[model samples]
Target: MDQDSQLLQAATDFAYYPGSHSDDSATEFLNRFPLPLIINALQTQFDVPGLESALVACLERLFKTKLGASLIPEYMPFVQVGLQADSQAVRSLACKTVSCLLENLDNSHKVAAHLIKEFNMYPLLLDCLINGNEEVAAGAIDAIKKLASCPEGIDIIFPSNKGGDTDLGIIASQCSSLGRVRVLALVVKLFSVSTSAASAICSLNLLKLLEAEIRSADDTLVTLSVFELLYELAEVEHGTEFLSKTSLFQLLSSIISNNFTDSILRSRAMMISGRLLSKESTYSFIDEQCAKSVISSIDGRLQSLDTSDRDEFETALESLGQIGLSIRGATLLLSGSSPAARHVIDAAFDQQGPERHGRQLAALHALGNISGETRSENDIILDAEAEENLLRLLYEAASKSSKLTPSGLFLSVLQQDSEIRIAEWEL
Candidate 1:
């Protein structure tokens, strides 16, 4: 066999070898075909059609074991070269290797610092983020997040000074809209790492970059992308405080209230708005006026949705549940002149077809959420009419819908509140 064929066979052996066994089979295997040998072959034999792919697969499997992961730092030079290789697959693999390397370390800060200050790989990672393909870009994002976990690393990723040589804002300015979106997503990830990381992100005013993208409204696809990122940010613990500092709450409410906005964008905006208010801890971040505006906008949306708009209808219902997660938000839903609460009840009892059944499921979930299915006793403050609606939902959902049942839905809610329990028994 030629050298390339020989290396391919060796890589296949490495990929298939079970490294998790007690016998240290990976170590035994490496004794015969060391990582250095494979790295040397990869450096010189990259031109060989299948060698790079096989070696990369072998490396990925090896990364699953402690012994295999411990050996990667010595091979950083090959990784650096792979990141700059002409082939997309190789660059993506390089990024994955960096992630694996960081994920496995006990003192990752040391390696992270070396990668940035000594190995000079940070720029190459950024290059992959900006110019790589989808897989490569995802891997780069993951690696950058892993690097950002440590205080020193996060400082490097988001420096104190704005518009510095390494500022992500500057990097994003050089990216296409899609690339900028990717960077925005990276910022969210970094923000979730620690409080210090979040402080770093806020201090540099990186969120304004995302806000600028959303307000530009020039590209529907790009705007949607930023909204999705905002949704992710909203999901992070304490992320709402970071978001509340910006005008994002008002911006999202505007997108939701605007009849001219794209339906899909409006739907996403409503869901994001709901998420911002869902957590009781974060509920106070949004002022009363803004929250009321959101409820009104979503009510208008639900009223506008017909049978043909099932997806939007379901989305709006789900968003309502998110909004009504808190007692205050649910109070707005139940007290408003808008028929939003009635609409939720009607949708829950609407058992027409498979499509309506789907909406029915979402509406049922929304109803349970709105009625304090998961709140503390002191927090579960449902009024008489609202209590009547919950009881009605239990009764009607059982008898009215042959295709579904609300027994499982109400069981938990029934357990939480004595009044509802008594009402349920009295019926």
Candidate 2:
């Protein structure tokens, strides 16, 4: 190895320090190669190929230790300079280091406050977010998420009172479609931090950006990306309630209801609708009619699909399972005017051959959910006719030994209520 390679290897060894090393070993390592000296070398040796990344790996591993983490705040100037570096690699490394700094710090909030207020790093980070390569942008996203973990950081991120030059909405408007998608992703990240952050996003009407993307229907890929982010937001705590007030549900309903839209997009819309209604708490915030409309839209979409549209067919079943996770959702699916739960039943028992196995599995899962597998017997949401269908299937499974090839049906039958089990036994 050359001089630079040897130096990097040595730094890696000490930073990583395999197996159990005592405090004395760390002190010895630090005494031999002090953290500041390494930081200085990193800045001065920026031109060396592979030196930046290797040293960054060393720094990240070192920061995992208490000794290295304690010195993070002291090197804030280095981070600030690296953030502004002309080299995209250096900027990416800097973003990662900012995350490393906050992650290891005992008082992350105070240090994040310092970075936002004193160092004025948000704009630089935002620049990385908008223009950097994939790794750089990802690092910037993580750093920004850490910054938003505290109250003061939240204000800087969201900027409640006025739209600054650094406001996400302004940045999004100036960006290309791709950049706008990145901004939406960042918004989702920020929204995941706390209810207050979610409220801030709503207060700023940032979700309108997502709404606009979905409604535009100009680009299938872009709209799909927006739906993915929407699905992510739906999975966050209390996310359904937050989305309830928006026109998103109605928009998704229309997409699912429309025949000309991309089947994949309609499938995504169906899943999002299911997720939004998965929790009962969501019902408190959403209108009953809106929920019904979403379910009906999905039901209509399912009914329109022939067996050849296997992807949409399977996804619609899975979406119904998500909705059936709750009692009201199960009731809506099983007892609706069109009765979408029947699709789940037909999918479970009607299909044959290995080609249709996935469809059957999805149906089995939906039936399990609707029958309250995770809930008590009193909580099973299937109505009388639906319940009767489920029992009849169980009884048929129990009576006929020839019908157990798709073991999922037999397993699902076994997972039913004790009363149903006794009835199946008698049959």
Candidate 3:
């Protein structure tokens, strides 16, 4: 019999083999089906014009047989072909199969090396990263991670967004929240592995794009995902440097201003601000323009807070404390803005409030951080009543618990040392 007929007979015979058959006999019989037959079947199953389901079935059976890995060399062409499959299901299955093979780390590396030599796979994979369904995109990311250490792979995956005019801009614009989340997750994973790549990606304006989406997206999960990605990116070396750019600061201000009711987004914004301020260099670049934007955002939120908005307002106040600590330009924020401060303070002290004490405490801390004591003579405008009220609040907070003693101590320092007060409070 010819090779095809022989392979078909072997497949039929193997199906009938008893479960208790001797290992040696079973191994020998299974070995009778050559690697080429398995490779051809996988391709023919998936590559035919309208036989994607059949292809998936064939691959599933082959995967069950545990013979796919052994035929990696013969399957390489199919992988390349599958990456560009018109049907998302077929492409997704291809990615799954590749990921399954990659479970063997050594084999994964070898496949990656082979893939590097195939130039088409790199761009095709990038396209998958941008437009594929979540499963397919996730699988593509897994494959890229397996090969990320390869120079060619890194080169392919880490290009500047401006390198070539492609559809990513359009895709990013029209992408669903699920698609954006998957793409952001992949980009974040890549950043975790290589700081240089992270810096490059950041400079390419990906963060700005994500920040725009965060401002407009009403979906809590999508906002949470984007915020988490930004938080992760900020933790990288020089990550904050990118964030300190004017565009990013403006975007952040816009998001803060939008003030969606999602607690997670509020908390995430607080976390990101804290991390970005951890770098001293990043702090200096947040100039007066950025400060005005942030202050405007805070003012807008304050005006929107009613009894129903208590939870969201309190979360925003906590974020304000974080912002006060990190942003050097914070002193300029809310200056001559008594209405905004009064609104926030009123919410903080509201009876039966959602986060009454916590909100008051944070606002008090922020007020101390940005008061007029440190401002130049021309810039200073002391609000004696506000200062006295802050001190009273601190005293009350200190009475409530030993935990607030430091807040009391800081308040005393503000009262006693004019220099510390001037530096923090001066715009």
Candidate 4:
């Protein structure tokens, strides 16, 4: 048999192995088979219908054996096809393959750029974001997130409308309940890319579409993602003004009253409250009731902390603190049972250590926000030692990291606070 046929046959036979093979035999067989042949077969399968099932089966074997890395370069085109394929099964497998490839940062950029250039794939992906099966939508969103990580990829994926009928309005309007949910999740992931594209996405009035979802949808993922996206957008220059015009506070109030049972949804609501509270326009909404609920949530989680619950609790507290900063409400919230919250904050600070200094700086910014309302009170004073530590963290973050979100916010807040004196020290 020719080399190609032999490789194909080997792939086909490999798919049926139910258990692990002995290391020596597996190593010998892998050594005999060239990587290019595997890539050719997978790429060919992309255009041929009904071949994805076999390809998936074979790829699973290859992935299991750690032989898939060699085909990383050739898999991008197939990954694109898998993303846009009419077959849900194929699309699902394609998503898994792309996710696996993303483990290598170099491959991620190459594949992401290629996927972004596949213009025909956009509408289908958008549709998948709105109407495809759940697995398909998840996969498509995952692909989009990876692609959006690259600036060139974002430019290609989110191109400007050339003045024709390119408004996302019709698509956004027609979204079914489930579609809206998935779209919200996708938008949140997209918004998390970088500040530049995030600004562009906000300009597209994507949040308006999300506001519609927040008002009409009940899905936890959708609601949470919407809140997260809004929070990110609010951190941008123009986002606060855009958010003020919407009935965001009213919608969040409704969600709070009716859906507190859903922890995920509640968590998102708290985050939105925090983001809105960061802005002056939404400060009135953070009344006694809202503060109490947020504090209670933090207290409850802290009382019964677990590894899984720590991340969510930290997020809730971070948002709560931001809200407190926006409205000068942290003293009351931080007074009683504040130690647990402080623990969470301090843990967030220490987790980043000196190497991940940006995260430490963000923790300091969060601390600043939390302490802003009570800087005068001895009960919640910003001690000199803590201030020095925060300054050190911010300096290290600025000098070392490229441009992290947390550290950026840290620098902005530190610069705004006249109490912070740079002339006294370096960084």
Candidate 1, superposed: residue stretches over 4 Å from native: 1-3, 18-23, 106-108, 305-308, 336-339, 349-361, 383-427
* Cα-based lDDT at residue 7, candidate 4: 60
TM-score ranking, best first: 2, 1, 3, 4
- Choose 2 or 4, whichever is better by lDDT: 2
Q: Who wins the TM-score comparison?
A: 2
Off by over 4 Å in 2: 1-6, 15-26, 46-49, 352-354, 381-427
Candidate 4 on 228-328: residue-level lDDT in tens?
Answer: 66666656554454455556656665554553356667567667766656555544433455545545655555455554554455565566557546433
Model 3 clash pairs? Answer: 45-55, 373-422, 374-422, 374-426, 375-426
lDDT, residue 391, candidate 2: 58
> What's model 1's overall lDDT?
0.76
- The clash count for each model shown is 0, 0, 5, 0
Name the top lDDT candidate.
2
* Clash tally for model 4: 0
Q: TM per model?
A: 0.83, 0.85, 0.57, 0.50
User: Which residue runs does candidate 3 get wrong by more than 4 Å?
Assistant: 1-74, 85-90, 96-114, 117-119, 158-167, 170-186, 212-232, 235-238, 258-275, 278-304, 320-393, 396-427
Per-residue accuracy of model 2 over 1-427 as CA lDDT, tens digit each: 6656766777778656666544466666677677777777787886777777777767666665666656667878887888888877778878877776677657567765776567878888898988888888898999999888888888777675577878888899899888888899999998898888889889888888899988987888999999999999999986876788789888989999999988999999988888888887888888888988898888888889987898899889999988988887887776633477777766755435667767776777777787788556678646686666555555554444445543555555455555434422322
